[model samples]
Structure formats: C-alpha cells, structure tokens
Target: MDTSDVAETLDHLVADATDHHYSPYTRFDWVDELDEQQWWMTPDLLSVAGTRHARELDEKQLMRLSKWEAVNFFSLNIHGIRELLIEVTRRIHTPGFELPSEFFHRFLGEENGHMWFFAQFCLRYGDKIYPDKSLPVTTTEEDTDVAHFLVFARILVFEELVDHFNLRMGRDATLHPLIREVNQVHHDDEWRHIIMGRKLVGLLYEPLRERGDQDLRDRLDLYLRRYITASVQSLYNPSVYRDAGIAEPFAFREELLKDPARTAYHETFFKRITGFLSSQEIISGSPFEGSRV
Candidate 1:
C-alpha cells in the first residue's frame, strides 16, 4: 500500500480504538462481593480439565476448581498483555508506523492497566499469581523479516483465541457482574486489536508468499500447529488439579489428553484458529487440513 493509504488506515483504526475507551473501575459493580456458595462458575468458561473432571468432585472441590481456573486464565491474560505491551512500546515511536503507532501506544497503556487489575484480583484472593511456564519459540530460524512477521502473526493467533472466549463471556449476564464487565471491556478493546492483527498478518504474508520462501512458509505452519497444541494443553493446570486433591496431576493431564470429551473440547476452542490458518493458506498442504477438529 502507498504511504497515503497506510496513513488513512491508521487514522481510522486509532479513532475506532479511542472511541471504545472505558473506565475499568466504574464499568462494573465491583462493590458487590461474590460469594463462593452463590458463584455459579460456568463449566464452559473453565479450563478443559477443570470443567470435564469437575463432575467427579463435590461442591467445595468444584468451587476450588472454578477459582483456580479463573486465576489461571486471568494470569495468562496478564502475561500475554505484558508481552504485547512490550512489543507495542518498541514499535509505537518507530518510523513509518507513526499513525498506527500512536493508537497502539494507547493500547499498551490500557493493557498495562488491565494487567495491574488482574494481578490485584489474583493476589488479593489467591494470595499469589501463577508463574508462566509456557516456553516462547521463534517463529522461524530464517534470518529474514518473514521470521519477525511470523512472530507477530503467532501473537495475533493467540489473541484471537483469547478474544473468542472474551467476546462470549463479556456479555454473559448470567455470570457475576464483575466477571462479565471485565470480559466485556476486554472484548471491546480486543475486537479492534484482532482486526488490526488480521490486517497486519495479511500485509506481512503478501510479500513473503510472493517471494516463494518455502522453508519459511513451512516453519510458519509448524509454529501455528505448535501454538494450537500448546494453548490447548495449557488448559490443564497442575496447580488446579493439585489444589482440588486430584491424584498425580501430570499423569492425569496425560490421561485427559486422550479422553474423547477433552479432545472434543480442545477442538471446539481451536476451531476458528484452525479455520483461519487454513484460509490463509498457511497449512494448505499440511496434515492438519485433513485432521479431525
């Protein structure tokens, strides 16, 4: 695209993002405390193991599982936002992307504030936050711009996965109002982020595909598969299982991976991600195209 076109696109995106700004403190009725007994933690929003295996537990066990999953999901959000903020800050003032960069600067600030509030909830109730154990991998080994582009693409994919849940839970009036508001506000911002991510990935892909970089393309496909698998597996939090008195957490995770119910749940969560990857032709000739959802 020409400079003028890029400038105009960036301006529109910034305006859209700016118009969605919401007050985190007043958006929800935070004054209403949630009771463990009254809190009806929806199984669909819980992690795979927590939801699937929750039927075997009693009331206290269920509550523990629900709280743990909530903590885990929000903790992941905190870490993910932190990483994205760093990337946004690095590019915000850089040349060529000044227009988009200005909006992203606001995004970074908002996400930073989100991290603080999420951390506060975890610390205040759980007494601590879970540590991030997921290992970061380079999108490709190639020493080219495609590698960097793929990194951002993978980040976008992850954001989409989170946004899927956020969009659903955000407006769910059935859940606690505070939880719903948090999700609602987050989904509003993330909708713009996802759109920007899609555009950025498309722009990055066009040139790389034009150059016919087979190795880079192959690596991108592999990275996408790895990310999907890792994200699904992340739903099995050992701490949650341990806290709920489940025996041999790692062994349980391995077993759960083989369960039909668990596998189906993972497929559901990854349906959109896989579809998008395929539509982008990133996995056109790959085995995943024929794999079961």
Candidate 2:
C-alpha cells in the first residue's frame, strides 16, 4: 500500500536473500554439450510460428533459427543485466535508501552472477554479444525526484518484459539443458527483483501526481510503450531469420511483425504488465495497442 509497507516487504526479502542465492559456477555444466540441431527456444514460441511462412521452413531451418534465437535472447539478457547493474548498484549506497540498501547489495551480487553466466553462453557459442543498436537518450530535468521515479519505473517495465521470457523459457522442456537451467536460475532471482520494482515504482509515482505533471505522465507512458515494443521485437532478430536462410529477412520481419497471430502473441507477452500499468493510470490500456512491434 504505502512506501513503508513496501519497505517492510523488502525487509522480509532481505532476510530471505541468502536462502535464494545460487552459485552460477557450481550449478551448470558449461561444456559444449548442446546439440546444434536441437532447439534453444520453443517451436511454438518462435517468431514465425503461427504465420503462413511457417510452411516454408524445414526442420533443419527451424533448429538453426532456434539456435541463433537463443543466442540473441541470451545476448539481450546480458545487455539488460548490465543496464540493471548500473542502475541498482549506483543507487545502493545513496542517501534516500535506508532499508533496501542491504537487499540491494544482495541484489547486485546476484545480478553480477547472472551477467557472468549469460555472457558465458553468448561468448562460448555465438562468439559475440549483440551490440545494442539503440542509444538511450537521457533528458535533463529540473525535478530530480520525478526523474528518479521515471528511471525506476523504466527499470520495472524492462524487468517485467524479461520476466515473461524467463518464466516461459525456464520451463520450456524443448530447450537445451544449459539454456533451461540459465532461464530457471534467472527466473528464481527475478521474482524478488520484480517484487522490488513494483513496490519502488508505485512509491515514486506519487510525487509526480502531487506535482500535477501531465507532461511527465505522457513522457513516461510513451517511453514505457516504446521500450516494451523494442523488448518484444528483439526476440525476433532479423539475423536469426537470415541465418536460417529465410529470404529477404527484413521484409520477412516486417511481415511477421504485422501478422495477426504474431500481434496477438505480442499482446500476450505484455498481458500481465499491460493491465497493471493501465490500472495504475500510468499508461493507456494496451499502449502498444496489441501491436507490440
């Protein structure tokens, strides 16, 4: 309810933090044991799954696509975790944090471990992490508090998007053992991170409300929706399609993105967050308008 209630929840989280910690080192076998022909993502979850274009691909192509799709997915995680580490770690010993800092320390440790394992996968197999193509723009604002609120809110938006992937991929049996284990470990850690994010974002939003800042509201709404679209779109890498030998990868990406089935799948990707953001009056219901492209 209140920020204090949020802190209380975090206190409980901090108390239980040690119990949830996993050593990325000991838990997974890092050998080159993956079958290149095996899938790294679920076939049903593939970008082109429900499209008529599905008929064009043979079994070998599907496996090849899933292989790189996995690389793309894990590379995105590596990028995301690094971004979060920058945000969370910088906030840890700062003035405002009184109760959550201890938990944040624990959080930072877990995230660092996640970065290591995720990068290991990308580097070991793909030999390169996907460089982030979009540069983030930071706007200077007079209201530092409002800015702080937006930063944390943006973090929540990003976390929840990845949370959907982790929730599914962790349990998807068709994926390779290493990928599944990575997904599950990250999922376990992210449960606490998402809890912290929802609480923190709600607490920060009240200040903007008190200031009667519709401009800021509109700005955040736009950012959140755009970020969601970008996150979902990353899952459908053009390189994955091209490498799979799909013709005209860019044109195919455009077609698949607009496909009704893919559009609906995009909706499902943001389903949990869409309702919550709408209920919070933080954004319009389904701001991506079920077209999360």
Candidate 3:
C-alpha cells in the first residue's frame, strides 16, 4: 500500500478509536477493592504457564508470583510502548509522511497514556518496576536502516501476539471485572496500533528486499528470533522462585526453560509471529540461519 492508502486506513482507525475509547478513571470503580484471596488468573485462562505453576505454590508463594508477574508484564508493556512512541514520533513530523502524521500523533498520545497508567500500577502496588533489559542486537554495517526497521517490526510482531490474548480476555465476562475492563480498553487502542504497524513494516520491507543485501536479511532474522526468545524469558519470575523456596533463581529458570510444556508454548508464540513475517515476505524461509549468540 502507498502513502495515500495508509492515510485512508489510518482515518478509519481513528474513527474506530472514537467509537471504542474508554476512560479507566471513570469506567472502573477503583473504590471497589480487590480481595487478596482471589486469584488474578481467570479460570478460563488458568492454563498459562505462570498461572499453572502458581497453582502449585502456597499462599505466600502465590502472592509473590502474582505481584512479580504483574510487574513484569506491566514493565515490558511500558518499555515496549516507550520505544515504539519514540520511533513513531521521530517519523511523524519528517517529510514525505504528511498524510499519516495526524494518525501517528493520536497513536503516540494513546500509547503515552497507556505507559503512564501501567507504570502507575506497578509503582503503586509493587513498590518498584522491573529492571530494563536490552534485547539482543543484530546488525551489520551495510543497510543499517533495514536493521532498525526489523527491530520495530519484531516489536510489532510481539505486540500483535499479546493483542490476540488481550482481545480474547477482554471480552470474557467471566474474568475479574477490573481485569476485563483493562484488557478491553487496551485492545481497543491496540487494534489501531497493530494495523498501522503492519502497513509501516510492509512499506519499509520492499526497499530492503530490492537492495538484495543478504547480510541485512540475515540480521533481520536474527533480531526476530532474539525478540521472540527474549519475550519468552520475560515470563520467568525470579521473585516467584525465591518465594517458593527455590534457591538460585537462575537455575530454576533454566529448569523451567527445559520443561516440555513451557518450551512448546514458547515455540507456539514465536511460530505464529514468524509465520506472519514469512507470509508478508519480509523474511525468507531461512530465518535465523548461521546466527550465533
């Protein structure tokens, strides 16, 4: 799609946003307190790795796991949103993207608001957020712009995967009312974000492929793989392990990584993402070939 098509798509997205916009401050009754005894994991979604493992723990262990997992998830969202906002803001005012600039401005405002509320939740209850960890870098001298594009593309891929879950969880009335509302609000905005990202990534990929830079393609695949791998690692909660009386949280992480169920789930998530890239022709079939680190 060309610039005009993108601008049109964005206009539709903006209209959709207007239809779905929600204010957490007003929509959710913050005065209705959540009981500590309630499980944060909705019954229908209890099969998630962390939730399944959490069931094996005692009350103290479950509480620690809940707090750590909540912080970890929120922290990742904060970091990811910040990075994407920077990228969008840098390009919004640049020449040649005038038509879609207005949509991007709205996107940045919505994401910034998301980052603020997520960070606020972490700080209010968790006391502190999780530390920032850099994703593995995969780049080469030739066609550096392709490398940068791939970084954001990989991020978009992850966001889409999470959005799939959020979309489902949001509509489930059986879930905790507050959790459902949060997911509903997030998914509403994310639908527009994912559409914009897919269009932008496709636009960026054509020139890179035209250059026929094998090294650039290789680096792109490496970045994609590293992003998916690290996303799985994000699910590991060292604090949970510590509370469960497991010594050497790192070793426990390693053990959990080896578990067949966990491994399969991780692969399932990445496979869905990689499948999208492959279908889009952004990455060839030989992804992550001859990459080490």
Best lDDT goes to which candidate?
2
Better of 1 and 3 by lDDT: 1
Mind giving the per-residue lDDT tens digits that candidate 1 earns over 110-206? 7776787778667765666888887776443565456546656776877877877777777767667777767777777777777677666666677
Q: Please give the lDDT score for candidate 2.
A: 0.78
TM-score of each: 0.86, 0.92, 0.81
lDDT of all predictions, in order shown?
0.68, 0.78, 0.64
Q: Give the higher-TM-score candidate: 1 or 2.
A: 2
Best-to-worst lDDT order: 2, 1, 3
User: Residue by residue across 1-293, what tens digits does model 2's lDDT show?
Assistant: 35679878898888777876768778788877577798888777788888886777888888888888778877888788888889777787787766678888888888888889888888888777877654464556567776777677767777777778888988988777778888888888888888888778777777777778788789878877776777777777777777777889989888887787787777787887777778888887675564536
Question: Runs in model 2 with CA error above 4 Å?
Answer: 135-142, 290-292
TM-score of 2: 0.92
lDDT of 1 at 76: 82
lDDT accuracy of residue 150 in candidate 2 = 67
Write the candidate numbers in order of decreasing TM-score. 2, 1, 3
